[model samples]
Target chain A: MIRAQKIGKSFGPLRALSDVNFEISQGELIALLGANGAGKTTLIRILAALTRPSTGTAEVAGYELNREQQQVRKRIGVVSHQTLLYGEMSAQENLYFYGRMFRVPDLQSRIDELLGLMELKKRRHDLVRTFSRGMQQRLSLARAVLHQPNVLLLDEPFTGLDIHAEELLTRFIEKAVADQVTVLMTVHDLDYARDHAQRLLVLHKGRLAIDAAAAQTTRAQIVELIRE
Target chain B: MNSLQQIYTILHKDILLELRSKDIITTMLIFSLTVVVIFNFVFEPGSEEMATSAPGILWVAFAFASNLGLSRSFAREQENSNMQGLLLCPVDRSAVFTAKVAGNVLFIFLVELITLPVMVLFFDLHIGPVWLPLLGTLILGTLGFATVGTVFSAISANTRSREVMLPIMLFPVTVPIILAAIKSTSYLLAGRDMSQVWSWLRLLIAFDVIYFVVCFLLYEYVVEE
Candidate 1:
């Protein structure tokens, strides 16, 4: 579902990714492991069709990233630190707005299902500014998946969550994975990655350092690979 | 869905958000009134000078006040990177510019609806038969304001000091609109026949068309990440 062949990105003298090569099949849940400046977000941005690689080509869901950006964007969903939702808008309004933006078929029913799924039904009418951080984060996830995208790109999805909220997000992402939504997530929580992700891809200094099946790898081994 | 439907979806969200907060309208309305009252102090009542300068002062107040509203509306989108969200939609990015232009046009029109009577009363202008032509001038002028304002607003929204960048880039480009609107308005306020102002009205329409199409076409590059 995701392919990056020799993808390289540079900003001035700094290289964010160098000759990165990888392919993620449909339903493959990947926990992208890396340090800061390791190009996880850069790679995610490229695959999400938000940024272009300087030297190589990439594709998402059969659409080339550079040429078919709109098509690629329609197939992929992204969740980042910012929720990408209007604070003054209600959760329901936010979803409805995205529903129409994505032209999701049967939009109202899908919105209702998402509200219930995210446990935001009771508070759907309240402005997002009044929502707690955890609630806002949950709504962000809900907005990402609202379009029913084929690919999910998550950058630090587990940050700023209380135990309960984290667990809720964990369950949501797991379900998305089980349903064959291609998932590539950048996460710092190695234990969480080991437990949830089927494969571990590590990056260091804008280069791919390791790629291994999660079940065959230990937390120490992954950490050692990243440190190297 | 076609781009119009996407444009409508964005326009609806912007209007809905503005309705709930009323921040942009309130800010614009109050700012306009303040500009008018301050100008009221600068010149004595009913002097030939004030009478001649009133249209210029009024359009200046409007141009500046509408900038405040345009900035605020985009500031709302900038809050959560919602502009980025809008860009990621699978439609042509020009829809973003059109929808925002429509929203700002509505807000600027509402502000003018309040400001016009206040302008008339405050400036002691005679509005007999020229009201229709006067309203036409206002709509065309506001279209220009909302048009160029929407373009520069998108441009500055990406900068570090948007409030500083907007006026710097916006003011010079809109000289023709301000000049045309002020001249036509001056003619209207002087109780001149509408036919006498046809040249200026044509100029305003021409400026509106040129800017609207150029801004629409150039918008994709401005807002691209």
Candidate 2:
């Protein structure tokens, strides 16, 4: 569903991503594992068409990443550490706002379904500013999936969630994969990645260090790869 | 859907929110009235010279007060990282720019509508038939100001000194709009022939078109990560 070849991005003297190449097929849940400043977010931004590469080319959802960014954007959903929601508005309003932006058909009904799916129906009318971090995170998840985007890019999505929230998120991800949505997420939690991601791609110094199926690698081996 | 429809939907959402909260318009109206009152106290209203300069004073007040509105136009988005959600949507980034410009225009115009009657009442000045032409000039000038202001606001919103940065960056670029608005406003107020005022009006239109197109094109680059 997505292909990036020798993609590199640099900011003046700082190289954020270099010689990066990867691909993901439809319905695969891939974890982008990297330490701080390991170019994970940069790669996701590039794939999402939010940033243009300094070199090479990428194709997402069969559209050229740079040339057909709008189409690529339509097929991809993104969630970062920030909930990216309007705090002054209710969770329902936030989703409705994005639904209008994407011009989703039958926006109200879609918002209702998403609210129920994210278990936010009870708190849907309350201002998001009043929400717990966990509730806000769940709302963010619903917002991302509202358009039923084919590809999902999550950046540190589990950072602030409590255990219950994490479990709910895990179930959501499993269901998303079952529904045939391609998932690419950046994570620092190896255990979460080990359990959730079918494939793992590790980044070291802005380069791909390890790309393997989760089942093929043990925790010890994965740690050894990171050490190398 | 087309980009225009997408922009319209976003703009409609913002306007509905503003109507519910009454935040931008209320603040802008009160601020503008205070400015007019301050100007009145500083300059005697019945004096011939002061009456002659009333149009300039009115627009200057409107311009500055509208800047306050523009600053807060994106406040809701910036408050909780709502801008990221807007950016993540599939809509074109330029659509975001267009929607913001439209929203600012509406808010600024609403403020002007409310403030104009107040200005006329306090200043005790008769608005001539030329008031219609002057109103057109104000709208066009406001459009130009808001277009560039929206772009600069986004740029400054990400900076360390956003509060100070926005006015510093915006005021300099908006000199042309302010000058033209004041000039044309004074001409219409003085009841000068419309022909003579055409030059300033044309300049306002030209500035609006130029900045509108430039800002729309550059917005994608400004907001991209």
Candidate 3:
């Protein structure tokens, strides 16, 4: 469902990603672990077709980056540190806007279901700005998966989520994986990544340093890889 | 959905947001009114200076109001990185540009609509038979303002000093539109026949077309990170 071949990115004299290569099969939940400048978000942005790579190539859901950006964008969902939601608008309006953007059929019902699933049905009409951080994150998740994307890219989704919101997000992600949706998430939470992800990919200095199954690698080794 | 549906969807969202927050429209209307009110005090209402300067004052107010509105509109999109969310959709980038332009035009036109009547009343001008041509001139000028303003707003939004950047970048490129609009409005306000305003109107139409096409083509690049 996702492939990258020697994907590289440079910001002037600084290199953000260097010859990074990875692939995730359908239904796989890969946790991308990295330090602050390790280029996880850059890679995610490249795969989402939002940023053009300075070198190499990437394909998501069988569509090549840049050349088939619209097609690629249609199949993927993204949630970053920012909620990507309008604070002035209601939760329902945000979902409706995205649904219409994606041209999702039966959008009203889909929005209702997602709102209910995210436990936002009661506050659907409330302005998003007035919501709590957790509530906003949940709504952001709902906005992300609103179109039923084939690929889900989450960048530090748990940054400010509370325990309950974190659990809710985990379960939702599990459900998405169960439905054969590929997910690539970047996180600073090592324990959660090891516990929830099927595989782990660590980036050190903008390079992929480790690619291993979660069960086969312990927490100590993962920590060592990140520090190294 | 098709491109038209996509455009309408975006435009609807913008309109809905504005209706709820009254952010862009309210700021623009108030600012434009303030400009007109101040200018009314500066120039005597029934004097010959007022007759010659009304068009310039009107468009200057409009230009400043547009700058405010465009900056606020794009800043709203940049909030929470909503512009990236918009870009992530399956629609063409040009559709997004078109919708934004439409939204800006509507907001600016609404400001113009409210402010125009106030200007006429404040200056004690007799528009009489020229009202229809004046309307046409306003729409053309607003369209051209929006067409150029939308693209530059997007560009400036990415910069650090966006508030200052929008006007700095927009005003230079929009000279032809403002010049033509002011000229056409002046002729109509002077009670001249349509024959005189026609050439300025034609220039406005040309600027609108050229800017729309060029901006439509360049938007895909401008918005890309």
Candidate 4:
């Protein structure tokens, strides 16, 4: 589960997110929609405990963001625009390192399964830097899920992916949600979000401008809402 | 995993990466060796002045080379937000700090180990009688340097112009270590009894403990967002 109360964040001269509140129940697939500088990534960073909120509070997986960050971290997985994979290490090495770091059980088998799931088993021994962007993104996903975290947070995961890669990522997310992992992702592609996300949460000017069931809210209306 | 296990995992990862790239160790080794050779040219090999100054030159070379290694170590984490990824784990923050400190000490110590004999030969000093004491001084001094350097390296890594930021933040805080190392090293080189450098050794140990404890306690803040 995820909860935020009056979350506000600011850089010295710029306000990135302000007075935003939202909650998601277990296994809910929620997509956060916003344009550039709309605080989508900032919100996810706060949830991931990667950054502190200047004002208000956030709790993820029953742990307070600021007070119990380690516990919070234990329960969540994050995949951002940054791949977070070490280029110097091989794909399997990256997964092994994170799996061991998170104390995952039977890590070797789990890594193999994820590598196969990401279609990276063939390239598992190659260094990350030598891989294409799609391969890197897939490995990044493998790294995030290596621990089988209770919650998943992704920021613009489909940004640079080709159509095939995007579809692969979508299938993986669906599988994760089926396994009852609470999912929150930031997205620009309303069509993909409409088809894949059960709920849509939109942000504008650091405010929660829209929250609606994805199937009921047409893409045209969502676009108009974003424009407003 | 337990904190010690986590520490080994991190240290192992760094060592493997370094082995593959040969980036940090190779760069620091070449840079330090060049500096020592240059110092030989500057002070004139086998000169009496070079004998008195070799320890100072050694520490200076080690210090400059260390700065490069520290910068490169953290810079690897900066790649692809690997640092954030590491921080997101449930492990203690100090595990990351301790692992990095150990890795840096290993790399810098290797640099010194190779540089020392060349230093003795080029500077024309007898190291046979004092090798053990010299090794002890190098270990203590390197520990002091790595403890404080790790913290400053993290602080500077997050800033713009990180290359410029590292030395400025590092040098002031490490003054005690650098001073103690230079004095202790000089005394060791002079062929005096260990008691002659006791005061400097004590200072080095004291500073090493202080810096190590401070860095351990404060590392959470340094790495936190």
Candidate 5:
């Protein structure tokens, strides 16, 4: 589970996130909804242990976010719009590299499984630079989950993906939640988020404006809420 | 696995990539040789005065060639947001810095290895039994250069004019390493006694230790998103 209490972040005179508080329980797929510059990325970075919040505390997987950052990092998997794969390396090599970093046992078979699951088996040996955007996104997903992290954070994961790729990603997210992994992602596509996420949290001008179970929320309501 | 092992894996990957493409090595070699050839023509060889200046010429070639290689070290990562991929790994950011320093050290050493033979041939200067000291100087000097260079290269990699910004930022900070390295190399090449050369060697070693530790500590700040 991930919990943030009064999390706030600022840059000089500009405030990014202020007094933001939320909790993500195990097996919950939470979609973070915010327009550009609405603090989704900042909040995610703080939660991912990549950036320190200006105030408040975050606890993830029973570890205090600020005090036990390493532990928090170890429990989390992340994928952003930037597919963090090395362009010169093959998809398998990139997975192998990350697996080695995370100290995953039986790394080769783990990589193979991820490649097969991502439908990248035939292209596993090809350099990431040669792969199309959708292919790279799929591989990026594989890289993030290489260690089987319990908590996953994805920023704009579906960007630039085709319908087929989007379907694959949706399936991946569903399986992740089925396996009891806590998933949090930011999205602009309300329809996709509406169908996929178990909960929706909206951010407006760096403050939480709406938090509700997905089943209770309506697309029109979310659209109107964000538009405000 | 430990942090060192992770660093080793990354370093090994970089080295293997370089070996396969030979891109960095070839450019460094050609550039270093061109600088050496130009120096040879500008200064008459085998003259007593020329021997005194050879050490400076050799180091100038190395510093420039090293900068060339350092700039390219992060080029692959800069392209297509690969750096973000590397950063997303849960590994300590310092490991990234260390791996880059090690890779740059290896490339610089390889370039030195190629440049050394050519320096000897072009300058007609016999290095004598000072090979050990020369080798020590090369390794230590390269360590200092790579330690600081890796940090600044990473900094410049994020900037708009990375190609122009790297040298401007790197050269000024690295003046101490270049100076100490050139001084020590000159003393060693001249067959000076160990006692006389000890101070400059100490300076090089000191610079290497300080920068290596400082850079390791400060890396997390530079890499933080």
Candidate 6:
């Protein structure tokens, strides 16, 4: 579960997020849609415990964002545009490193399974810098879900994903949601968000402008909301 | 995972990455050696001035080289925003700080270990019975440098001109460490009695402990976004 109450964040004169409020029940897959500088990533970063909100408070997986950050972090998996991986280390090594940090059980098998799914098992030993953008994104995705986190926050996770990788991600999200893993992702692709997520959240100029069910709202409505 | 395990996992990862890439250690070794060689030429080898200046020269090399190493260590984390990834883990923030300090200390110490013999050979310096004390001084000084450097590296790694920001933030805070290290090293190099060097050693220990504790407590805030 995830909850945000009157959250705001500011950097000097610029306000990145303001009075944002939203909540998602367990296993609900929500898509956060916003244009550049619309505070989508800021909200996700707050929920991920990577950044503190300048005002109000949030709870992720029953842990308070401000005071219980370590507990919150333990329950969530995050993937940003950046791979958050070591290029000098191999793909497998990177996963192993995170797995150890998160104390993932049966980590080697989990790594092997994810690497196989990402179509990177053959290149598992090669340094991450040697991998292509799409491959690295795939590895990043693999790293995110490696711990089987209770809450998954993905920020533009599809940035460099190819068509097949996108499909794989969709299926993975479907499976994760089915398994009762709460998911909130920032996505630019309105069509994919409409097709995949159970709910949609639209942010405009540091505020949450729309919160609606995807099945009830068409992509056109979502587009108009984003435009507004 | 436990706190110590988390620390080791991070330290091991850094060491593995360094071993594979040979980036930080090699660069540090080369840069420090360059400093040593340049100082050799500047002060003239085997002269009384060179003998007197050996400890200062050695630490200057060690200091600047460790500066580079600390900058690169955090810069590596910035590459993929791996620092964020590290912060996202379940461990205490101090674990990350401790791991980074450990890695930096190891790399800088390795650089110093190699540079010392070269300094001795080039400057015609004697270790005598103070070799152990000299070694102790080097370890303490390196610890002080790393404890402070690791914190500054994280702060500066977020800034635009991180390379410039690191030294500006680091050297001033580490002034006591450098002064103490240089004095203790000079005393040890001169074959002074341990009693003569004890005061500087105490100061070095005091600073190292103080910096380590303060940095450990403040690291969580420093790495915050």
For this target, which candidate reaches the highest lDDT against the unseen true structure? 3
Please write out the lDDT profile of model 4 over residues B26-120, one tens digit for every residue.
Answer: 99999999998888888765778989988889999999899999899889889888999998888888899999999999989998999989888
Ranked by lDDT from best down, the candidates are: 3, 6, 4, 1, 5, 2
Please give me the total number of clashing residue pairs in predicted model 4: 0
- The prediction achieving the highest DockQ against the true structure is 6
Candidate 6 Cα misplacement greater than 4 A, ranges: A218-221
Give the clashing pairs for model 1.
none
Q: Over the stretch A1-228, how does candidate 5's per-residue lDDT look in tens digits?
A: 999999999889999999998999999999999778889999988988878899999998889988887788778998889887877788888888889888899999999899999999999888888999999999999989998999999999999998888899999999999999999999999987888888899999999988898889888877886777
Clash counts for all predictions: 0, 0, 0, 0, 1, 0
Please list the residue runs of candidate 1 whose C-alpha ends up more than 4 Å from where it truly belongs after superposition: A11-14, A215-228, B193-196
Give lDDT tens digits, candidate 5, residues B64-128.
88888888888867665667666656677888898989999999899899888888898888887
What lDDT tens digits, residue by residue, belong to model 6 across residues B1-225? Answer: 489999999999999989988889898999988888888888755678998988888988999999999999999888889999998898889889989999999999998999889888888888867788899999999999999999999899889999999999999999999999999999888877788799999999999999999999989889985
CAPRI grade, predicted model 1: medium
- Give RMSD to native, each candidate: 2.2, 2.0, 1.5, 1.7, 1.9, 1.5
Better of 2 and 6 by TM-score: 6
Off by over 4 Å in 3: A216-225
Question: What proportion of the true contacts does each candidate reproduce?
Answer: 0.76, 0.75, 0.94, 0.88, 0.53, 0.98
Per-residue lDDT of A1-228 in model 2, one digit per residue for the tens? 888899999989999888988899999999999778888999988987878999999988889998988888888888888898877778888888888777789999999898898888999889888999998899999988888999998988998998888888889888989999999999988998998898999888788877899988788876775666
- Model 5 residue pairs with clashes: A84-B85
TM-score of 1: 0.93
Across A128-195, the per-residue lDDT of candidate 4 in tens digits comes to 99998888898898899888888999999987888778889989999999999999999888888898
Better of 2 and 4 by DockQ: 4
DockQ of each: 0.65, 0.60, 0.82, 0.77, 0.54, 0.85
Give the lowest summed-lDDT range of ten residues in model 5 chain A.
Answer: A219-228
Which candidate, 1 or 5, would have the higher DockQ against the true structure?
A: 1
TM-score on alpha carbons, each prediction:
0.93, 0.94, 0.96, 0.96, 0.95, 0.97
In candidate 1, position A158 carries an lDDT of: 79
